[model samples]
Target chain A: MSAVAYYLESAGIATTGISLVRENTKALRPPRFLWVTFPLGRPLGLPGDAAFQRRVVLAALALLDAPSGPVLEDYPEDVPDLPGDDVFACPVRFPPRASGRGRWGSALLEEIALLRPWYALSRERRGRTTVGVAGTLVETLAERLGALLDAPERLPGTLAELTELKRTLADLRAFHEEAVTAQPGDPPWREVRRLLWRESVLGDAMLTLRDRFDASGDPRLRAFTRVLVPRGALED
Target chain B: MVRLSDLPDYEREHLLDKNLGPLGPPAWVPPGTPLRERRVALVTTAGLHRRSDSAFDLTDASYRVLPGDLGAADLVMSHSSVNFDRSGFAEDVNLVFPIDRFRELAEDDVIGGLASNHFSFMGAGLLPEAYEASARDLARILHRDGVDTAFLTPV
Candidate 1:
């Protein structure tokens, strides 16, 4: 929105951005725009809920009529109590997933389980492989699961390592779960092994993938990999 | 103190002044005094999208293209998981991106002109390479159209 304001202003258009998030307003520089009250994703309103959408839209348009200056409009703080059927109930709910339904709930659970050991170890050793590992695992798992559930792509060499890492993580998670349920002897050692296995798989996969891709000079792929396995945090 | 490890490489460079090299004018611009009277163009990351373009996809780690125009009634907002839609702007929120407001401003003679083309790209990919490439391409386009200055806003 700020960009819009800047563009318009630069083009001799007096513009204002009605930001819903307050933090966004704080980050914005001057000679640009203002903020307003709306939730994160439902900027317009619950999808299909034309009434609320119209009200919000009108409120935004109202800012233009106000005298020049950044104005923060707090429309009746009546945050809608949208029902489940509400199209804009949660923006995240709308996307297509591998399962084609409620995969977000499952993904959230998996991520939490995966991060448990990483968070625990982060407290003991400051270096717990980057969060990118978790992201990579999830993406790889999703892609693989999608392939298994839908269609398979001829597996790329780089992806093979990621699939292996995902398998290793899943196995470790299953083992930890069993150990916890069974009250097995020396569970701590077992847990340590699980953590180590997870870390090693991710770390090794990342290094191999990075080396392979980096050698090719494909900036897009490199960027993708960088997000998957970020490095150089150890450097000062 | 935020650790370097806590920040991504591009972020580190942006914060630590590592990539603060000199920037010249757009490649298409002629040398000498062109910078003085250049018309400015604006591109926003506010997720200002057209009505027809697909909603920002959070799942895809790759960048997606946004629409060019969003008609009078259509709204613009980012719902992409990667997109940090912190602004409380409404879903039909044009004020934030202010495309409509810009039109009004132009009509009122507040600013001299509006760019014929504005660009928007989803901002979730962690690395800046693609964005840098897009920006360079956009700059080239703007220069080709004789845009002198550009106003950039990252949502």
Candidate 2:
């Protein structure tokens, strides 16, 4: 987005932007940017709050009048609280296996179970699905991931290995969420994304792997760790 | 109320430095006149596209055109980022793409009339080159639409 803003400004179009990730906006230092504390996907704050959303829009647009270059302002108003505070209750918590080695095979199965009904409803409505992109079944994905977790020594070492590991993780996320794209009256999308990031069995398993590799002192591994797994933080 | 302190330090550092390196200096075009007299457009990096358009590829740097007057019902978000819950956006398009807000602003002549068309791109970890081109193209659209100011929202 900083890049897009720069491009627009370079082309003689004055640009002002709202940024969810303040870091990215600060680093890029676009001509004009407003850092908002809203959730990632919902840059304008919660749904059904058109007034708030409009206020956000106006705030961003107001940056256009700044006379100088590289202006960064923080949105003054804090986002109003959600209906419920951040208890983050959900049915998809993943339990580690009996061995407790980050292998949640049964938990994966449980997630698949919890997601199936919603998956079916989504398919009925859209006549399609977001899963199956990796061209593998859910069980197969579980088994393959289990194999990887089963052998910590065989964890990704090279760039290609790390790339493959990340790809596999992507497949897992897609398969799971496309498996259940919240029914019309279901929870908000950001909540689902947050839950998946915070508590998915596979996600936690991957985090364990990331911690293991982050200790390897390999720069690439460290970088991949940040990508595949945050430093155990749920960020916007 | 949301506060910067609510975000953990690591996430702050992560955002402060995405490893993309310094983006170098941007070409600055000063707002020559009062914004109320200028033509404008609204664009987003929220991965929004029309229901009639193909969904954006997860890492796609390409952009899609959104008619300024298109119904919000016709828009949908197909994002690939893992940072936020999309449930709110899935329910309300205005959370990211505030076309309705822009339209209202236009109706009130708060700034200026909107461009003939707007734009969207799936923007997480986007390739600079691709988005550079996308921006160049967006500039053309802005030019054709006689737009002088563009408001962007990143999700």
Candidate 3:
């Protein structure tokens, strides 16, 4: 890919990239130079074939002598596409980590960060379906917490209401754990929502605690509140 | 075929002897010729490639080319997932495959000036014909540039 070439050139590696896709080359910026007009994904020729790869490499190296100018050297425009064998079929396996933790741990951490807006941006860009679902759940939780914070007067007075909220929160946590542990090909979005439900419960509890402190107005509580909440909240 | 390791330690003192056949007379150079002053170039098969370029797809096969000017800060590496800095090939990779090291030796008055460019190729191809052709072309370029010797490093 031209991106690879650009990075290498930036790294101060003397390189001239050859590719058949003209547009790919055009998209690249200056300073990291390359030669266009080679076929896609086969810069050094076909897979498992030695001679062709060598010729391509040699041709690329020869560009170094081209009078310090950056230019695209198109090979025979008429060379027909030689359908090659599938080269990427071989799967690469990584060694097991000593801690026994797998990619799932990293996935969970990513989900936690996704609960925030700035972190959500990174998660969305990864284009993973699971992340999108998790993000939606986090947004919902934030909205509920926002409403509860805005209206302490409307707080649930019954234990039944509180129990229902707590139950939903427990279910959400279960879902979050499930989503985090889901392997590839597992339905990820569903799991994300499950986790979001779990986190919302915790958010509700925190909001309730804050509201209770404000309602009590105990001297110590008021003193603590004065230190914790901004002066603007006290005025409100 | 002689195994280089099988050669007695005494005969393996020189770098050239290690490279060339030990039993044969050394390749002739002119009298007053400075081995230290010989222009040296480098070629590597580490798959050091530009992202913009097409990927080199051959297994056990590689090609060589004279690289453009590059430095450590500019390199974007991708072959293995290992960290590049830990590999300690920074200076060598930065200088386009240890040609800078050769240049350093030259600067210390140990060798001659380096060739203007060095070569690189991803070492994944299996066939030799193309590599042979490329090497021949490289040899021709070196001859044209009056290069006295070259060092090849297969990745």
Candidate 4:
């Protein structure tokens, strides 16, 4: 981001930006940047808090007034964690998984069916969903991902297939997160992420797919599979 | 709130290793006008695009145009790196793309005006310099649109 700002400023457009990583901004200093201690994704600090967001924006924009080569400022306020117990467990409990590889696919499909109502309620309530990035239906994506776990070779190695798989995994993640949040209590994303990665059937299938894809011996497939699950999840 | 030190070790290492040296020399251009008189536009690295537009590739350096009037519901994120927290974005697009806040700022005269067109790029899995040409191209568009200031954000 600092690099891009440098390019833009060089092209005669003044730029001011929020730096999530202070070290990067300090190294590749741009024309002007405001460093915030917010998490990786939330550059504006808190979500849905207009006043806090406006303050963050105004603070960053205020950097535009500086007459200098490279100016880096830090946002003063730190976003507080959500006010609630951070522990989260899925509201809907499932029977123990059937033990064989072939049965995992059926288990995944069944899980999808179980979560369908909650996902629908979530979409109706929010009037929007982040589930279509892969451009595939939820059912089809679940089935395809599940199948890859049992028969890794069944996966096609084409670019389109690779892209679809990456996005399908993403969509599935979003679908489960949305569905889980719609049930009873609203959980903090950290706990929800932990639940998705450690306790869910879909999470198991995804990790299985990641392992099989990494061992597929195709460089292109391996390259894309690395990001299928975050590094933090693996550490957990 | 989390700082770089609070991140997982691998992610912290990756971010630190992502430096592209320095882009030749630092470039500086003082704002050509007062904050209230400069036309401001948003440029994001969140890999956001309209529902009708194509999603970003794993290593794409290209950009997508987002009209100023675009709504929060019409945007979706496809950033290659899934390490960041997206719950904020799911709740409010302004957490990452702040278009609504920009609109309010414009209305309140904090900034002169909002550009008719803004830009987005998927900034992961590639070198930082890969964005140089595209950034230059976007600068031309911002220039042509009479934009004197750009507010950038990342995910």
Q: Report model 3's chain A TM-score.
A: 0.29
- The segments of candidate 1 whose C-alpha lies over 4 angstroms from its true place after superposition are A30-34, A84-236, B1-80, B83-119, B124-155
lDDT of 2 by residue, A139-158 (tens): 66776777776667766656
What DockQ does candidate 2 score?
0.40
Top candidate (TM-score): 4
lDDT score, candidate 3, position A203: 25
Report clash pairs, candidate 2: A23-B15, A23-B16, A188-B87, A189-B85, A189-B86, A189-B87, A189-B88, A190-B85, A190-B86, A190-B87
Residue-pair clashes per candidate, as listed?
18, 10, 36, 0
Question: Per-residue lDDT tens digits of candidate 1, residues A1-236?
Answer: 43233333333333333354444343433233334344333344343344554455445444545544444455564445433222211111112222333243344345445555534443233211112212334445544433432322223345444434334333233222222222212122222323322433333333444455566566644544543333332222
Docking class of 1: incorrect
Candidate 3 docks at the CAPRI level of incorrect
TM-scores of all models?
Answer: 0.35, 0.68, 0.32, 0.94
Question: What TM-score does model 3 achieve against the real structure?
Answer: 0.32
| Tens-digit per-residue lDDT, A48-108, candidate 3 | 3334444444455444445533345654433234333222111111222212222323333
Error of 2 at A128 (Å): 11
Q: Judging by DockQ, tell me the better candidate of 3 and 4.
A: 4
Query: lDDT for every model?
Result: 0.38, 0.68, 0.37, 0.81
Best model per DockQ: 4
Looking at candidate 4, what is the lDDT of residue A11? 96
